[model samples]
Every structure is written in C-alpha cells, then in structure tokens.
Target: MDKPTGSTVSPQEALIYAMVTLSAVDRQMTDRELRKIGDVVNTLPIFGGFDTDRLVAVAEACATITREEDGLHAVLATIATSLPKKLHETAYALAVEVAAADLHVEQEELRFLELLRDVLDVDSLTAAAIERGARARYRTL
Candidate 1:
C-alpha cells in the first residue's frame, strides 16, 4: 500500500481493483477469483470500453496497496473517488461476486464486503439486494 502512486483510476479499472483486493484479502487469490474478475470485465457493459490489457497491472497495483499500513482504506478511497455515484452499487456487487467466487465466503472477505458497502455509501437495503443477487448468480445445484 505505500500510498498508491496515483490518486485516480477509471471507473472500470476501479472496479477491477476492488475485485482484486477482495480476492486477495484472505492472503490467497484463487484461480476461481481471478476467473471471476476476467468474466466480469468481459461481460459487464460497464467495461465495454475498458482495455482488458490493463487487468494484470490493475491487480498488481491493488496487491501492492493491500500490503501497506491502512492500505485497504487507501484502496477503498481510491475506488470511491474513481467511480461515479451510479456505479457505487456496481462496485459493491463486483466485490460480493468475487467474495463468493470460491463458494465459501471467508471471514476476511465478509469484513471486506462490509467495508466496501460502507465506503461506497450503499444503503443496507441496496447492499442486501446486491449481495443476494450475487449469491443467486453463483448458486449451484
């Protein structure tokens, strides 16, 4: 986290960073989580104009920040600043999706999601809906 060198990032990149941070919060980023991030970038209309080539760099940046003291806060602040109000819930949704990617939500991931909800200013009701939607999407028979 060494105070991210840059203060701003595009909304799409901000979303990717959020997902990357959530995936690594448990100190391990699984292939499932990484795949989920790639799926998101490829399918989400929000990312229609985003350059997929930057995914690796964005994830690396997130990983670097997560190692610094209060890096989580720094990363969340960057996410909040980079995304427009309309995409706040989208960001939270993306985090929740990544958290559930492995089908087992770790305590750290849950805490990160809570922090993300608060940082993104997503109301409890909206947060609940987003969380539920992600759960339904990732559900298996």
Candidate 2:
C-alpha cells in the first residue's frame, strides 16, 4: 500500500499494522482478537505515548491496504518497510499474540504468521519462543 505522502510509519504504528493484519488474515476479525489488540495498545509500554483513539483509524488504514489487489503482499511490504530491524521481533510477537487471542489458531492465521516471520526475518528460535509465550498466556484451565 503506497502512502500518498512520504512520511514514514512510526514503530508503534508498524506494530499495530502487524497485529491488525494477523487478526484480519482469516477474513474474519473476531471480537477476542480485536479486544486483545486494544488491550495490547492500552497496556504495552511501547505504545505508552500513543493515543488510544487513533487505533481505530490506524487499524482501518491497515484493513484498507489488505483489501486492494495483492493486498496481503502489500500489507507485508508496508510492514517490512516501516519497521526497523530491531523491532521486527516485536512485530512478530504482537502478531502471534493477536493470533492466539481467540484460543484457536486457524490455518490461515498460521500461514500469515509464517509469512510475517519471513518478512520480519525473525530467527526460528525467537519465533518459537514468541509463539510459546503467546500459547502460555492464552492457555485454558
């Protein structure tokens, strides 16, 4: 998705885009996933300075990018270009978190995670750890 202007996407926005993309990957955005996204933005230190109200707009922008021709590719490209190397893992982690939100990992979501991991260049070990952590956090009784 090409931005009309030359301004870069902020780190926090990049993270949000990743989460939103993952949530919408299955073509169905669940309430649990949406709530997890909101909770993450509200509670994470990385988003401490971000305004919560802007989340809907940012997520809508991401959803728009994902609806264009080759939208998934476009969204991944935007994410890869927007995020710095250091925060790539954070992006993947957030994606994993959102995917795990509903306590059910669908095939589409899993594929999206794989695609995201490759795009973010997250090492296998780190990706495994992130996935494990999300599983642990979302575990049932």
**What residue pairs clash in candidate 1, if any at all?**
1-65, 1-68
RMSD of every candidate to native, in Å, equals 3.3, 3.4
- Lowest lDDT block of 10, candidate 1: 1-10
* Candidate 1 lDDT tens digits, 1-116: 22233377888889998899999889889999999999999998999988889889888988888788989888888898888889999999899999988999999999998888
TM-score, candidate number 1:
0.92
Model 1 / residue 48 / CA error / Å? 1.2
Task: Give the per-residue lDDT digits (tens) of candidate 2, residues 50-125.
Answer: 9999999999988888889988877788788888788899999999999999999899999999988887788899
Model 2 steric clash total = 0
